[model samples]
Target chain A: MNDRTTVSPSARTTIRRLPELANHDRAMLYSIVDEAYVCHIAFAANQDTHCIPTAHWRKDDYLYIHGSNGSRLIKALSAGAQASVAVTLLDGLVLAKSAFSHSMNYRSTVVYGQFEVVQDSAEKLAALDVFMDKIAAGRNHEARPGNSKEINATSVLRISLAEAAVKVSDSLPSDKDEDLDLAVWTGILPLKTTRGMPIHAESGEHIAVPDYVKNWAD
Target chain B: MNDRTTVSPSARTTIRRLPELANHDRAMLYSIVDEAYVCHIAFAANQDTHCIPTAHWRKDDYLYIHGSNGSRLIKALSAGAQASVAVTLLDGLVLAKSAFSHSMNYRSTVVYGQFEVVQDSAEKLAALDVFMDKIAAGRNHEARPGNSKEINATSVLRISLAEAAVKVSDSLPSDKDEDLDLAVWTGILPLKTTRGMPIHAESGEHIAVPDYVKNWAD
Candidate 1:
């Protein structure tokens, strides 16, 4: 059963040093998760831990991550091992007055839960649709439909966002009083992820760029 | 002692499912590690796993990660729990004819090791300088120097890139013959992280943007 408990900062998720930056608002959690296309899924296997980066998407309350049925991590997760998923969007470089104070402005979310494999064919299809649309609008309909073999060969794991933690560090760089007069430039060098000009595939060169793909931006 | 063993596909670092895409070349590993600014660190703490995103920089064969001395993860690492650090750079989106064939073009590296605290003040200061230049060139010399207290307050964990896994996926989308003729746009929507115009702090607005920060790019 999916846990629907309200997310409270447990000893695990609490931001100890900078407690003010911890956020538990549901909207903020959803926004941070929605703004990214990739996540790192970490799990313990063979007496060691590994974090695998993969594509991810969010629906109402569940975060869906799909991978090949043969993936070891997928098999391990399906066996009920708890997984930790993290998504991070680096916003900018915070340049402070002192080297010790330099930091990055970023928004990140960490979700910890046991993933249940989506076995129902219909649910799997719907999850696939959500994944495609999350990556690009109108992509599922535009692309060839998923066949039964394809659906069966894929493993879709669903995790509830009930025990999630969201942390945001967007404050301007602060300096010590004594360092303020130092002859250094102090400001933010904002970093942005932008969509560049599309490059057509070998056979797709003659195909016109679809408006959905052309106008897509993060 | 830092582990200098050759990077092999051990049980933890092996790319089992997609073995063809695995890369272990030292130069390729260094290149992938050098190109990114942020990494997601995953570790098991308090019976739950957490993957926190933080800025990272590589020097020679060691990867340095610093955080507040009171951070739970840092404390756990110092106490001798191994960490799994993953850095992913999204190069483009692969739009394919079939949903199952769609994938992202990216370069990522995963390093697994226990971190040792850099207790020597000189080594710690030099590591901090390397970090500053990695983020923004000339940032360290331009900024106010770190005092002894500040140096003591920070925890810099050094992990040798001994057992690491690097994966680069730059392939164009390939689909089944029947699905290739589908009327879908098949191409790459390249994603790039670029620097935006600098925004100065309140008192630093009058200072000219330095050439080092101005030319910084990832």
Candidate 2:
């Protein structure tokens, strides 16, 4: 159902400043969510707003998040609190000729909606499997699945990706005509999220390293 | 000063779940903020809550952020809207024997406060220099400084780090005794933000590369 490509679904979602950086493609929104392992969710409760980071994954047109049943985030979100979720990937630092022109290259997406509690047990289990698969492909089949009690104590919630905005700034540094002629080094110092060598747990030393672990750093 | 080591200075900042993972060290809180380039801010405006990502820099015990004077974030925060800011660094994924035990190793901090606008022109310029130093040391002196008109069009704001909560999860993956005996490879796939090669802007190719850009990826 991601064929819908229009963005800025509402007044608040519209990008008022630097509107050129706004991306209208649905795939752009999906890619931003898929690439990020964590997202910050903003919601209000008890006259205070909170921005909390948590693991997230996406399936179809819904972005899913799970938390302990007793968590304040879960308690407020499940009670129909409006939520704003943001995922950002910093790509590089753009060094412009002028201090005011210096900027960062990043890809970010924001979703605005009310999170719906995923009440169906079967759907919840499927969503959890999707999350596990994201962490490590084929991991759901290898690991022991969550028990009934464990499932009951966790709350799964999803927000529709229909109302979202994506912004991407990946271009090279730009400077004013006068500043460009100045003797200054200008370019992009790229930044990337890369995987490092795996660290095996002591208890799993006897087990063979899976393909996911082997290819992690590659 | 940062000598105050107490964390969770307010009731809402308390970590109720997995309280053992809560950190009380002020140094830990400062490190978390210092290491991150961006943070998500939660604020209410026009009856809608927003989670926005922006660049941040820490000076003394305050976290500073800047934007154009016309931006909504600058307008809302400068007017004394309450804010909840969160910075998170994901270290790795903890793959355990059981799906339910899977977790992530991360250091996260949340600060609750109202931002105070930087009114003094000299103070604002000094803060911007501090931000430049974080991006690339010695580059502030090399680049063309912001002129009076440019400085007048920007707004800088800072929030105190006094009321904050720090949560750190950096440990080997653990599983239930019964699940630990299963033939599964469990460990951490570490994630790191690394710098890549610098790409020179076409207009600045004649300029010599500075020491910062030369050693960026090193």
Counting clashing residue pairs in each candidate, in order, gives: 0, 0
- DockQ for candidate 1, C-alpha atoms: 0.69
- Candidate 2 structure quality by residue, lDDT tens digits, B1-218: 23466664478777898888999898899999999999999999999999999999999889999999999899999999999999999999999999999999999999999999999999999999999999999999999999999999999999999989899999999888889689988999999999999988864357888999999994
Please state the CAPRI-style docking class of candidate 2. high
User: Residue-wise lDDT of candidate 1 within B178-211, one digit each (tens)?
Assistant: 8877767788889988888877785546566788
Interface RMSD of every candidate? 1.8, 0.8
Quality of model 1 by C-alpha lDDT: 0.82
How does each model score on TM-score? 0.93, 0.97
Model 2's i-RMS, to one decimal, reads 0.8
Docking class of 1: medium
